[model samples]
Target chain A: MVRFIDGDTRVLVQGITGTQGSFHTRLMLDYGSRVVAGVTPGRGGMVVEGVPVFDTVAGAQDRHEIDASILFIPARFVLDPALEAIDAGLDPVVVITEGVPVRDTMEIVANARLRGTTIIGPNCPGIIKPGEVKMGIMPEQVFRRGNVGIVSRSGTLFYEIASHISRRGLGQSICVGLGGDPVVGLDFIDVLRWFEADDETEAVALIGEIGGDAEERAAGFIAGGGFTKPVAAYIAGRTAVPGKSMGHAGAIVQGDAGTAIGKIEALRDAGVAVGDLPGDVAEALGGLLKG
Target chain B: MKLLEHQAKKIFLDYGIRIPRGELVDSAIKAREVANGLGAVAIKAQLPVGGRGKAGGIQFADSSDDAEMVARGLLGTEIRGVEVKRLLVEEKLDFSDELYLGVVVDRRSRSYMVLASREGGVDIEEVASTTPERIVRHAVDPVFGLRDYHCRRVAGLLGYSGKEMFSLASVIERLYRVAWEMDAELTEINPLALTPEGFVALDARLNIDDNALFRHPDIVEALRLGGSSDLSPREREARDLGLTYVELDGDIGIVGNGAGLTMATLDTVALHGGRPANFLDLGGGASAEMIEAGVSFVMGDSRVKAVFVNILGGITRCDDIARGLVMARSRMGTEKPLVVRLVGTNEEEGRRLLESQGIPTLETMEEAADRVVSFMGGV
Candidate 1:
């Protein structure tokens, strides 16, 4: 089975009447995701892309047991819908909206954790299991169903790497973008643990950039025997100047703590093959797979 | 979105937290007048970045003459890469104790955590590494918020008792409120001084969250005003067009979609022997208008000798990027060498659009880097 979602995963679309929500809901349905219901405050009793719209998640959950929920609401209104989905017992709630405030994210994370719910990104390209389910905003042509597990903190870069892997005759089991915000759901360590447990994922490729200690923490976990699969890694922003926020709130170089060199060193020390550039990652992973 | 010291202190005053009386002055003569009224004062440089005291940006003076001399020494001078355009002259305080207090989003816990330490007047990071036990931390539940009991527990850890305990607790509570209401990533009052009168926030620092700025229009307007004065010409142009741009000390201008990819482009350009002059992210699903703005913004930078447009289209289509480049080149009439790397959705069409215009495009990041660096004389 896939880690978060697969062919059998019944979905409820949060903010489904909105532009992005409706558009992606149609895409997910086309990709064979079992989208059972949609939720919009005042748009209930309406049909969006052949899915029934309900007033709230509770109303949607009343008719069907939703395995997951994808949020496409505006940033300010995302927190309430996220909490409502968590309380309603959705396993892996995916938030596709960007610009979620840190405090709101903190509350959502805390409440979701207390209830054993998994939240994936407030600003991210969501999960994609190629040929099975496409639950996020990523373009589908780049992915091919296969054995490689891809996890990244970037939206376009994830697509870039995936296209390279697909071109190299390698395909993905499941790819997840953990978002670019300072605080996000499902970090590298969490995704790595899930990839380790999934039998379908033969190898893992982590696309981390300069930011925070996420890559370092993931290195620690891999070095400590937390994951047994062969891992390939690529880190961006080696030449980024310190004290500048490089678009992403989390992709800032604060002194030397979150620099690309430090992250590369940590991953190298963990016996993981580190690509000097994103182009090199696929070749490095191919070598690892053969060895 | 880091606020200057005086601005943070103003926010503190709004929360009923006592701050040392201060006046912001743009000239040394004005600083002298403010200092003369206060008797004894500190002339601190108004910059958003920290470590000003260590950088000699902060000076204490006993008289108006000394204050003017100190302000003259700091005004219009560069400190830690920032020019000292303004000085915050404030009345010095007499204190019996100096305590450290801060509220930050603890990434490890995924919660807002308050840090308290009896040892103050030094770097908190240094204190944490040297003496971990001296720093007390309490993770607050975001839903429940910073309760009085939580503040009391923090006060107890700092060894406060009775009236001082209540005073410090309430001050911490108010600081948390300021942090919460302001949507600050970090709210710190280093050396929350204990005078004979009460606990006063001697030094204040507030780093507001940029994402949450929509909830606070007042802060956004203030920051916009501050931006116009503080931002460089290229920066001001980029901000006007909603592009993420940061100037760097290099020669090659780099632009890409998404933060990670933009940074990667910079690194790739550097790897191939070219230094990046700036980092500009066109952002996800960026329109042709946004790309036009980004290209012209980079072209405006005098330091940039060459440009690299890196686009890995996911939600952002490659055709839009190509059309934007073609339009920008025709409209702006710039002859700067631009190396384009377009991949993913509609890439072939995008490349054709550029190739038809005599603008050669590369297929890979490595090829784009090699080409761009070659255009810049290989260094």
Candidate 2:
């Protein structure tokens, strides 16, 4: 039983006429996601991959019972689509578009919080519940239905780490890409709390990079007895030097607060099984599960 | 997007924050003339990073002739890998009190934090570490912004009183406004000095968000002007194509999936004595066309003796990247050394596609970097 999404969840595609949205919508439907409708604004009355299209998210909701939405809108128009989806009463919205301005993301995040809607990312790869629904760009073949919940900041890193777990015959209950942007909606602790409460998730894998104190904060939460399930973690950019800003503007370690070594040390001290290499992540989790 | 002191001061001036009179001059002769005209002047190297004074990027010239000599020596010299093309000649101020003020986006709290301190002209990090009470911080609401009351509260924390308190508070307000209006990620005044004349922003460093450039055409144009002209032709081409590329001191030029991977690749190269010639992110979901452009850009750099293609395909399909690589190689037609590490969906297909075309494929990112550095003769 994957968390956040399953066979019961009805999905709608925003910007369904776009190449990526159409392709992924078809993929999601084939993977057993109950994709009910698509929204293309002005391209209404059309059909994409057997899903009916409408002008707005409200129109799409009127036509189909869209419990959740996966947005594929361009970066500039991401905020509008997300707000529209939330306004239309979509429970959870997965935003796959990257490069949305931080200001726009802040507004979207604030609005989503106000409306009690879950907005995943404006720069993320979206989420996937193996064997039930794949709402993101993750390789479906690599993920299997299992009890390990995964959350990551980097999309590609998530897939690679998930592949490592999949090779060990241990699949994920649900994998969420929180996006690498500084102003992304959900934090590591937010996703961790969910995984902690989910009965399906016996353990969790957290993929973090150098930047922000999110990992350190998550470690504090775990150390404070906020989480009972064992967490296997891997922090990237360990060998990276300080004062060099990474690609994500938010990932810059200006002072001593944000560093890979600092984060790894904090997590290690917090009783997390930290993996030194990508392939070793599964082994770390296996050890934790055994314990 | 780090703005030099003079450029940052210009933004500060626009926001009604007072700054010492300054003029940017490129030649030593001009520097001498400006210094002489200003009477008592501070000669500062126009660089993007901090610790300029400690790095010898800043000097106080007693006479116009001395200013000229220093300016000539600085221009065309490299400071922290960035060439000093110009010098800012500013009138030095006699300060009654010195303070520190800055507005930086606190990523942890997801808020714009205003940092103020009565003790100025020193590194804020050092201040935070030693006497943490000296640094007073207040998170500004993005919606309401930095109000007068909020500034006063911060000023009170810094132990300011009377006119000095009022003046410092106003400066904080103005700085916060500039930071918000300009979409700046960081706006710092190292020494917000309280002179006999008034409160002045003695040193300024502003870093604007690169993503918000479209809305700020003026700032964008100003940044372009301040930018170095020593950029490679391919780098210029890539910039014109709207890709973010920054050259480093690395021989293994990397073009990758995202900014994070590009930087990680740089770190890997640096660990192996290979300086990455540039940080080029083809962006997520790069097509064959973009890859061709990226390859051309990387190969265009003479310093880049080798190229590393590190891709983690998710939404960006490995096959699509392979097609781009094949297209880029054929189009460029230069057998410049290449190392490719493609992982994720359709990785095997991507490997086969590249191998069929005789391009070398590595199993891991570390191996690819090492191989490229080795190919460059231990660069």
- The candidate maximizing DockQ is 1
lDDT of 1 at A273: 90
Overall lDDT per candidate, in order of appearance: 0.87, 0.80
Q: What digit string (tens of lDDT, one per residue) describes model 2 on residues A1-291?
A: 123677899998999999999999988889888999999989999989988999998887666777999999887788788889878878678888877777677667767766788878767778888988878877787788888999988766677678779888888999999887787878888898899888999999988888888999999999998888989987776544455545555565657877888888889899998876655678888777777
The per-prediction CA RMSD against the true structure, in angstroms, equals 2.4, 3.9
Clashing pairs in 2: B250-B275, B250-B276, B251-B275
The TM-score, computed over Cα atoms with residue i paired to residue i, of candidate 1 is 0.94
Find the 10 residues in a row with the least total lDDT in model 1 chain B. Answer: B223-232
Put down candidate 1 lDDT per residue, B93-160, tens digits, no spaces.
Answer: 99999999999877777877899998888999888888999999988888677899889989988898
* TM-score of the first chain alone, every candidate: 0.97, 0.96
- Where in model 2 is the C-alpha error above 4 Å? A1-3, A59-64, A86-89, A239-245, A255-257, B27-38, B61-78, B81-83, B228-283, B292-312, B328-355, B358-379
Per-candidate DockQ values are 0.75, 0.42
Tell me the lDDT of candidate 2.
Answer: 0.80
